[model samples]
Target: MSGRPPGAKSVDQLLEEARSRITRVTPEDAVSRMADGAVLVDIRPQSQREADGEVPGALVVERNHLEWRFDPESDARLPQATGYDVDVVVLCQEGYTSSLAADALRSLGLTRAGDVVGGHRAWVAAGLPTTGGPAT
Candidate 1:
């Protein structure tokens, strides 16, 4: 045995489970949805954003504060987090963390939560609009 608990799941397993709970969007699709008022939440850290650039107008909530900032019922929630029906599309450096973050949002009753497939790298690859250097 690898010494994990009886019911333990690997990171890959957790990621797979998270992805299954929501519909991931491509960079193009995410932009379209953004135009239609979807909230594009960027959860990358400052260092990553500094290196990879940022999505113009995307909410810059770092990963650590995501749950508090987006949780509708939380007192610390953002003004836009009015309810559970909000369309939240989370983005990370490479898509892995975003999937987990979106899953966490869903657990908080943000039923419309999802992530950008392939994350910032894909966005840069697709030539999507950004305000800084290309995603690394």
Candidate 2:
């Protein structure tokens, strides 16, 4: 231990704590909601998306720009980020980053923001729809 503090948190600890604060979905459930108009926001970088394919029709909102792209009041927000109540499901390569992304979105008043439990890898494993093309 570095002994910085008595209550210091590791990265894994932080990740688990973040996940515990939100509702995470399975790949199947995410697809079901996507079909029902819930926005599936992919936060993986473009290179990762190209390397392993991506959920077809999912919005590609790179992690770095997530706050600007999802915050409704921001001029940079995507049009689909309509309001605080919009159902948004964030996805990363392996589900880790997504939890943090969803938690951030929730902090921005997007109450329904959540992450796919196992991320895009799980989605592919579940045989969900995916496309191998340039990031949109």
Candidate 3:
């Protein structure tokens, strides 16, 4: 018998609640968008990326510097030479981190920002072509 409210959620449940705020898109959809000129931004750490071959044509932007680089307000930023309205998709190894990264990008006014739901692992699993380094 517990004294907590009937609907009270545990700590794990609360954290998961926050995680669900991020939107996710399927790997196939991401690929289609990429073919249509959407920039696929890989935010996996360099070591992981090097260990596992990267997606062909995906922009390699380390997670730590992603927000500053993508956020238009940040003076220490890379020029959005392709224009700010470009569709940008972020990816990580397992999809979790990329969701947060995409949400952050959306917060920074990148309305077209999104993340790969199944991530690079799913991309590889889906038989997509990759380049850079040897396959994991």
**Per-residue lDDT over 10-57 for candidate 3, one digit per residue giving the tens place of the 0 to 100 score:** 766753543565456788888899899888899999888888888888
Question: Residue 31's C-alpha lDDT in candidate 1?
Answer: 94
Ranking by TM-score: 1, 2, 3
Q: What is the lDDT of candidate 3?
A: 0.79
Candidates' TM-scores? Answer: 0.95, 0.91, 0.78
For 42-109, candidate 2 gives per-residue lDDT tens digits of 99998999898978889998999998998999999999989888899999989999999999998899
Candidate 2 accuracy as lDDT: 0.89
Runs in model 1 lying further than 4 Å from the true structure? 134-136
Residue 18, candidate 3: Cα error in Å is 6.4
List, residue by residue over 1-136, the lDDT tens digit for candidate 1: 5599888999999999999998799999999888998999999999999888999989999999999999988999999898999999999999999999999999999999999999999998998888876433
Worst 10 residues of 2 by lDDT: 127-136
By the TM-score metric, which is better: model 1 or model 3? 1
lDDT of 3 at 44: 95
Residue pairs in collision within model 1 = none
